[model samples]
Target: MNKEDLLKKYFRQSLSEEEEKEFTLLLESDHDFKALYEEYSNLNLAFKSHEAEELKAFLTSIDEQEGVKKIIWYKSSTFYYLVAAVLIIALCLPFLLKPSASSLYNEFYEVYPNVEQPVVRGSEETNTYNAFKAYEASNYSLATKAFEELLQTNSNPNYKFYFAMSLLNDGKFDQALNTLKDLEDLKFSYTDETLWYMSLILIKQEQPLKATSKLELLDKLGSSFKSKERKVLLQKLQDN
Candidate 1:
């Protein structure tokens, strides 16, 4: 294909794997193509700036013609600003709105820090307490090992939850999701929370459809603790 078509496909992320590889090779090796791409990038930015200025001028004209004197403060200037913001967002959507799964993960993922009381009352000696302490300190590797050792004999539901979180923090996404999958299936007290984390894992793995699916299930389950947050996340995924 021509440079124009290749660039268009690249921008749209519509190139096939092979085509993308070819494009990358050309971009790196061909000075002409590289310069063309840089030119295209600059032109893209310029076009966006020009369009934004035009949109702002149009909105300003409307506000001036309509006059803001009669409307309430809450409804007049606020409403017009809101309208302008929404229109600007809509106009810039194709270029500015990145709805990739990794973007979603970055926007939403947060580690569930240890909130458990030490299993042993005042001594910082026991394995369980040490595991909780490690987790609280964000020592995920130590926490994972300790949680794993504790679970070998205990099989405590809470232990599994913490283990999954530790694994997640350590970037063992698949293992963490496996443990969370078990928790979700059991419908345990932490099931909704499990689903929430599982969604985040899928998102980090670039599986937005799967992430959104899990979020939808969590929304249906409706945990009192996570209901509002879950709804907001679900809406965000759906909007994307």
Candidate 2:
């Protein structure tokens, strides 16, 4: 990609590994590109601040004008400021609200917690059970390893789903997304659930529109399991 597109992707937190590496190299080796990026960053901050302060002043003035006679909100200068301020704030809301991808991930990502059938006491437990035990105990490192081992012998979709979760917990996001994407297309019982997690992954990657697309797909599929969560998350993402 060119320098402008690379900088835009970097600001949007959507750079791939190779793109990120190239962006870093440009910052280190190209003085003009580095200077341009710094200038743009500063300009963005200044614009955000200006919009916020203008919006706040307009809002405060509306409250203060509540008791004044012969001066309606729409009839005063505050109204003009309010209109301009709202437009600017709308354009800059994402930066102003500071929506955090990690915060959203932590809020919605829940562990499956248990396997379908509980192992009976005195029964011979296998590596699969051991993996579930590790996951239940929150030992994701060991759980991820055990999950990979399970996948080696059996291509159980359930095992693959849990393995994807383990990778997500371990912060292997790209790998986890890839696994979830494959699961989403498999028409398994978890295909809907896979779509939900994939949407969350997209949100965490700062790709809200992509996440919205996934949510729309889930809605079209009539996924009752995640319908409410999907709606709430989609609203929150779109709001920012």
TM-score of each: 0.56, 0.57
Q: Candidate 1: list runs displaced more than 4 Å.
A: 1-96, 119-121
lDDT of model 2 at position 176: 91
Q: Which stretches of candidate 2 lie over 4 Å from their true place?
A: 1-98, 117-120
Compose the digit string of candidate 2's lDDT tens values, residues 1-240: 888999889888999999999999999999999998999899888999999999999998887777464467667998999899999999988776866887887788776555643545675679888877777777888988999999999899988898888888788889999988778878886788788888889988989899899899988888897677777888888777
lDDT by candidate, in order shown: 0.84, 0.84
Q: Which ten residues in a row have the lowest lDDT in candidate 1?
A: 65-74
Tens-digit per-residue lDDT, 1-240, candidate 1: 888899989888799998898899999999999999999989988999999999999999899766755456547778789889999999888747757677667777788866665544677678888889889888999999999999998888888999999999999999999999888888565777788899889878867789889888866665575666777777877787
Given candidate 1, what's the lDDT at residue 81?
97
Our tally of clashes for model 1 stands at 0
